[model samples]
Target: DTAVSQTPKYLVTQMGNDKSIKCEQNLGHDTMYWYKQDSKKFLKIMFSYNNKELIINETVPNRFSPKSPDKAHLNLHINSLELGDSAVYFCASSQQGSETQYFGPGTRLLVL
Candidate 1:
């Protein structure tokens, strides 16, 4: 069984289009996070939710938003998608305050 899962493993859209990705975890973790991996392979945390409470990373743009309907589910919404937004998005989960995190397969987005 997968500990973390993401929908639409690949996404390709024109610039200015809006998109959303869904994520779910069965690990019973209290903390879930979204990370972006750029073309250069730089990984950065975008958002995190603990117990359904949102924690936005300072470096994340306002156009990116994270929503958690429940502890096990988290979704990402990108508005006015730009070329720079194209990257591999990873969903991760861990116990609250835990250093170890399990990641999903990842969603690759391409803004044309």
Candidate 2:
């Protein structure tokens, strides 16, 4: 089984649209997280969920929201997508904080 997977490997949308990306992990990790890598390849943590609980990073924009259906899944919903949102969104998992995190291939979103 895939350890971690994200839907729609690539996404293209117009500005001000809404989109959602789904993620799932078969690895029974205790914690899941969302990371955004901008065009510059700078990765920043967006959110972290443990046991379906929300733990957001202060730098993340309110336009981005994360929902965890279960401990093995965490989804990201972007509202009013802007050109700035055009980047790679990665879903990752780890046993716990500051540990080695396993990352999904990534979802590339392109906003026009």
Candidate 3:
């Protein structure tokens, strides 16, 4: 069974469009995170949630939002998407206090 999963593994949209990526983890981890990898392949964490509470908020545009409905789920919603938003978004989960994380197959987003 997949420990972590994301919907719409691929997405293509125009600039100014709104999009959302959904993530779920079956690992029973208490912490979940959203990371983005740009075309340059630099990975950075955008948001982190622990026990359904926001824990870390990286310096990202306000257009980006992370929502956690429960411990096992974290979703990313982007508003007014721009060309810079084209990248691979990854969802990961780990136990509290653990550095190890299990990542879902990334969602590739392309904004033209």
In TM-score terms, which candidate is top? 3
Best candidate according to lDDT? 3
Show where candidate 3 strays beyond 4 Å: none
Give the per-residue lDDT digits (tens) of candidate 3, residues 3-98.
999998999999999999999999989999999999999989999999999999999999998899999999999999999999999999999989
| TM-scores of the candidates in the order shown | 0.96, 0.94, 0.98
Order of candidates by TM-score, top first? Answer: 3, 1, 2
RMSD (CA, Å), candidate 1 to true, equals: 0.9
Q: What is the C-alpha RMSD of each candidate to the true structure, in Å?
A: 0.9, 1.2, 0.5
lDDT of each: 0.94, 0.91, 0.96
Model 2 Cα lDDT, one tens digit per residue, 1-112 = 6799999899999999999999999988979989989999998898989888986565878998899989989999999999999999999998865589999989999999
Candidate 1 at residue 55, lDDT? Answer: 69
What lDDT is reached at residue 8 by model 2? 82
Question: Ten-residue segment with the worst summed lDDT in candidate 2?
Answer: 52-61
TM-score, structure 3 vs. true:
0.98
Tell how far residue 64 is off in model 1, in angstroms.
0.6
